[model samples]
Target chain A: MKARVTVTLKNGVLDPQGKAIEGALGALGFDGIGSVRQGKVIDIELGETDKAAAEAKLSDMCEKLLANTVIENYHIDIL
Target chain B: MKARVTVTLKNGVLDPQGKAIEGALGALGFDGIGSVRQGKVIDIELGETDKAAAEAKLSDMCEKLLANTVIENYHIDIL
Candidate 1:
């Protein structure tokens, strides 16, 4: 089994790095680009697990480590 | 129109930040988490633009700014 996990900053979190990327994009002639934000991606391969267990585990992973619940949210796609 | 842009370090790129994150996750008791990689996500809202034009613009943004072409690969999804 495989899971693609994404972690991102919640709305209103100041993102300096994202801003820098946007500035760089505009400078690079990528007009029409309004804003830029950054996040994290984690790919995990879990062997032969039940869907419910996987979901629970994935959420636990996010709450415990993958995301900073205070400022970030996470989603996982299991395959 | 909306697009989500993501930028990530190429494989073999030393990711100290990711390592720190993984360490923090472990400390927080997230076991079974093997590795962690960090990346960037950029969301843009373009008012009534064709997909082709957006693609071109996005590629330019990535090549020149959003991603370091030499080290990162980016993907954009139109919504």
Candidate 2:
């Protein structure tokens, strides 16, 4: 099974990188751009075939390593 | 309008960061993990309401700044 995990900053958190990107976009003349936030996407190929088990495992991985839960949220999708 | 941009390293590119994550996962006792790849996800809020125009502008952004096209690929999704 293949899975994707998206880790993003929580609301109210300051994202300097996002801010920089927004500024860069403006400088490049791309108008109408509002807030921009950056995150991580991890794609994994797993040997496990069971979808349920894979989701569970991926969730655990997020808690343990993939996400910094204090300021970030993670979502998992099985593909 | 909200949009998402995903940038990922193309196949055959050496991703040391991803390799390190894979090794770390194994060290943490997570087995059956195959190849792990890391990518970037950028969420943007745009003032443009037209989906097609927004997508075109986003594609331009990707080509000019967001993605290093020589070694990466990007996908855009408007929501």
Candidate 3:
């Protein structure tokens, strides 16, 4: 089983990295670009075959270390 | 309009970072974990309203700067 976790900053959080990228894009002649936010994706291949167990375990992983709950939101996709 | 770009390492690439993460998970008592790969997601909001145009521009952005085409593959989703 494989799980893909996406961690993104929550709304109203200051994103200096995103702002820097946006600025770089504009300087590179990418006109009409508005805002840019950066996030992370973690792909995990698990030995567990049970779907429910996998989801529960992956959720625990996210809460413990994969995401900063105060400033970021996460979504898990089992594939 | 919004677009999401997911950048992932190519198969057979050396992924030391992934290995480090796997080690960390094991140290944290996540048994039965197999392999882990880390990627990145860039979310962009564009001023352009046309879907096709937005897709084209985002594709160009990826080729130009968003992704390192040599070792990574990128997928763009228009949302």
Candidate 4:
């Protein structure tokens, strides 16, 4: 089974990297581009075939190290 | 309008960051986790409300600055 974890900054949290990318986009002539928010995606393949077990493990992984629970929120998708 | 861009390393390309994360997951006790790949997701808000225009601009943005076309592949999604 495969699981994908998406980690993104919480609403209202400041993202300097996103700001920098916004500026860079403007400089590169991408007009009308508004705010940009950056995040991370982790794709994992699991030896375990059970869908439920894989999602639970992926969630645990996110809680432990994949995401900063205080400022970042993560969603797990099983595929 | 909102657009999302996902950037990932091409197959066969070495990803030290992903490797490090994989090792760290093992060290942290995430068992049964197989290969892991890391990527970036950029969420952008466009002042233009036209879905077609926004997606086109995002594609251009990815080509110009958001992705390294040589070693990375990027996908753009309009939401």
- Index of the highest-DockQ prediction: 2
Per-prediction interface RMSD in Å? 2.8, 0.5, 0.8, 0.9
> What are the runs in model 4 whose C-alpha is more than 4 Å off?
none
Identify the runs in model 1 with alpha carbons over 4 angstroms from their true place. B20-29
Candidate No. with top lDDT: 2
For model 4, residues A1-79, the per-residue Cα lDDT tens digits are 8888989999999999999999999888778878899999888888888888788888888898999999999999988
| A-chain TM-score, model 3 | 0.97
C-alpha lDDT of candidate 4 relative to the true structure? 0.89
Residue pairs whose backbone atoms clash in candidate 3: none
Model 4 C-alpha lDDT per residue in residues B2-79, reported as the tens digit of each score: 888999999988988888889999999877778888999999999988778777788888898999999999998888
Runs of candidate 3 exceeding 4 Å displacement: none
Better of 1 and 3 by TM-score: 3
Q: Residues B1-79, candidate 3, lDDT per residue (tens digit)?
A: 9999999999989888788889988999999988899999999999999999999999999999999999999999988
Q: Which stretches of candidate 2 lie over 4 Å from their true place?
A: none
Superposed Cα deviation of residue A25, candidate 2 (Å): 0.2
Give per-residue lDDT, candidate 1, residue A66: 72
Docking quality band of candidate 1, CAPRI definitions? medium
Question: Fraction of true inter-chain Cα contacts (below 8 Å) kept per model?
Answer: 0.55, 0.90, 0.87, 0.93
lDDT of 1 by residue, A1-79 (tens): 6677788888999988778777776676556666667777876655436877777888887887678899998888885
TM-score of each: 0.79, 0.99, 0.96, 0.96
lDDT of each: 0.75, 0.96, 0.93, 0.89
RMSD of each: 2.5, 0.5, 0.9, 1.0
In the order shown, the chain A TM-scores of the predictions are 0.93, 0.98, 0.97, 0.95
